[model samples]
Target: MTDTATTSSSGRRILFRVGWIVLLLLSALFAVNHIAGIWFIAASTDEQQLFEAFGVVNLLAIVLLVIPYRRREWWAWLTVWLTILPIALVVVFVPDAIGITYVVTAGVMSLGQLATLPSFRPTRTAN
Candidate 1:
């Protein structure tokens, strides 16, 4: 590749990396918030457990995104869509602050995935 082409490719990769980092940070923030919510917001044992579980899921998302997803592994992408996306979508209909936040985060995450679609595509080699 020409110098210009190389520079552009690297720049694009950096952009994608930054996007993922932002998503991971957001997920971590939400996770911590949810876990702490048990102390301040949960009024019952079940609700406390529910909040903790959400925190766990958010942590899992951070792990997946940082490791496998960053490497463009197909399974990680599928896992996020299959697990996280559905949960966020369901929470979106709750008509509450947390619900709205969850949906917005999910939407941003989805857009990130779509924006990095080319990075995940299989490359072709010359014969």
Candidate 2:
């Protein structure tokens, strides 16, 4: 096995590790949303329907993202595209409800992308 080095430093490796951690954490939050949906559906609280529906959608996203998703998987990218499009719409139309959920989800996506960056780092040809 070879130790891959990019950008002439070890910081990229460290960041990559941190990025995975963040992705796992985000996955957990989506799991929570799934559970919360169960609770909301069982209760009679205000906006219970909305809570349940949102939970189901989030659970679908969690399931989609949880599977072994390589860059080669078209469905994986489709899942990501489905997730982001709604967030973008919400941010553009419902600006006031930019909640912690948005922050956490976006942060997770950002870190996950960053983690994969080093693996695809462009190679330079020596003259």
Best by TM-score: 1
Best by lDDT: 1
Give lDDT for model 1: 0.75
Residue by residue across 3-108, what tens digits does model 2's lDDT show?
Answer: 4434443665666456545654565675576467667444666456655555566566556555633332455634655654443454454456555457546656
- Each candidate: what lDDT? 0.75, 0.54
**Which runs in model 1 stand beyond 4 Å of their true positions?**
3-8, 90-93, 125-127
lDDT of 1 by residue, 91-127 (tens): 6457688677778777887776666665676654445
Give the RMSD in angstroms, all C-alphas superposed, for model 1.
2.4
Candidate 2 residues lying further than 4 Å off, grouped into runs, are: 1-20, 34-46, 70-74, 97-104, 117-127
TM-score per candidate = 0.80, 0.51
lDDT for position 103 in model 2 = 54
RMSD each, Å: 2.4, 4.9
